[model samples]
Target: MTRRDIEFDAEGVTLRGWFYPAEGATGPAPTIVATHGFSAVKEMYLDVYAEAFAAAGLNAVVYDHRNFGASDGEPRQEIDPVAQVRDYRHAITFASTLAETDPQRIGVWGSSYSGAHVLVVAAIDRRVKAVVSQVPLVSGLANLYALVRADFVGGLRESFDVDREARYAGDSPAMIPVVSEDPLGPAALPTADSWTWFTDTAKLRAPAWRNETTLRSVEMFTEYEPVAHIAAISPTPLLLMPAQHDHLTPTRLAIDAYERAREPKKIVILPGGHFDAYVDGFSVSSTAATDWFVEHLQP
Candidate 1:
């Protein structure tokens, strides 16, 4: 496997990551554009899948979202769902221009929040030939309610309102921790396990990872609905892999989305939590992913 540094324009900001050429690709090969979930950088685990894809004769392009990792952007450590989705489109366009991969055979893969982004991208972009969504964050409201207690729910909205006003007044966006020891803290993901897994992964593999995002990033979820677009992606092969015991994304949402999905779709329920897909969970998920890409991309 060989990797080279790469960058692409998402609107005007520059986002960067690595591009791995297929090990035995003799010509333009199938390609998959991939990235990480909320508050995560590519080095955390995307390389594990990209390396496998490259070894299997599939070109893999992994990149950091703007304002995170090595990507260049202002208002550092931001997480904008809409802007990130746009980046996926830019990445697909960039991947298609690569002489080493087949643009028409391009696919997309993502986990956690990005897992949901892949769904929306595939629905709107016919250029995406296939998709792999692992432990996808299906609904914004459901995800928010799960993280915050009922009593503080109103308080949460107040905070968002106040922050919105501050931003409108030209004040810098308030920052918040991406995860916290207390589920009630001013954080996005407050589960103890989420905190442990994120911190551990950052220390072990992703020194570039940041543990915070602008407060405004949280509100983007309220308007984003990936499930609404799942059915529109028919004829294009879709693979939904959600852990059986996923605590964060919730298995029920993925299953509901699967029920609504049309033919040319497959779902694998792994026996672990959401982060399991990163640890021992990758074996089944990646194996199925390789087979799916080979069948659909056929390059």
Candidate 2:
């Protein structure tokens, strides 16, 4: 499979990544627009899914959210869920303009934090014919509790308030590790799995990825639940893949969201934790996702 550099404008920021066209194709084909989760860059195994899509006779567009990776945004390394969501929307518009992919048959695929993103993207854009959200977060409150130690909970909240003041006053947003050696320390994700995955697995796959995030990023998590939008993604096909042992996003919350979603939806619960699905367990989920897009987007 071959990929080309690509960029799109979203709310005045330029998001950058790669666009993979279907293998040996000279004409437009079904396309899947994709992005990574919180504290992740495009190189962190997102290409695995995009290449799978390309090999499956579908085009794929993989991009970094604004303010992350090779994208252009101020206050770099800050994770903004709201801005990321808008970037996905603008990615749709960008994909439609590409000569390598079908304009009317675009799909959106995201995992972890971005898994929650696709739901909202699909709900608002009728242009998205299908969606694949893997181990999606149901509620920020639940996810926050699952990600950090209880003793550090108060510290996490306090960091946000402090960061906001600093940010507004032209001070650098409080810097926090995206993954820490201590589970109780302040970080976007501090579990043992994430520590190993981000520190080890990501280094192998996404060497360009940084392990830091802004304090404001974690602070914004509380207000960004997309479970409420899941129901609205109907008429358009939805594919929700939640890992069975994903403590980060939690399988139960995804199941709960799945139960509330409308028709024309399918859920495939696979083995492994949230980060596992990005590497060791990627095959199962990506296979299911590729088939879903081929079946829905291609028809």
Best by lDDT: 1
Q: Clashes in model 1: which pairs? A: none
What is the TM-score (0 to 1) of candidate 2? 0.96
Worst 10-residue lDDT window, candidate 1? 181-190
Show the colliding residue pairs in model 2. Answer: none
Residue 83 in candidate 2, Cα distance off native in Å? 0.8
Compose the digit string of candidate 1's lDDT tens values, residues 19-131. Answer: 99988888999999999999899988899999889888899999998899899997898788888999999999999899997888999999999999999999999999999
lDDT of 2 by residue, 195-289 (tens): 88888966687777888888778878877888978889998999999998988788988999999999998999988888778778878988999
* Local distance difference test scores for all models: 0.88, 0.87
**Native-to-model Cα distance after best TM-score fit, residue 210 in candidate 1, in Å:** 1.5
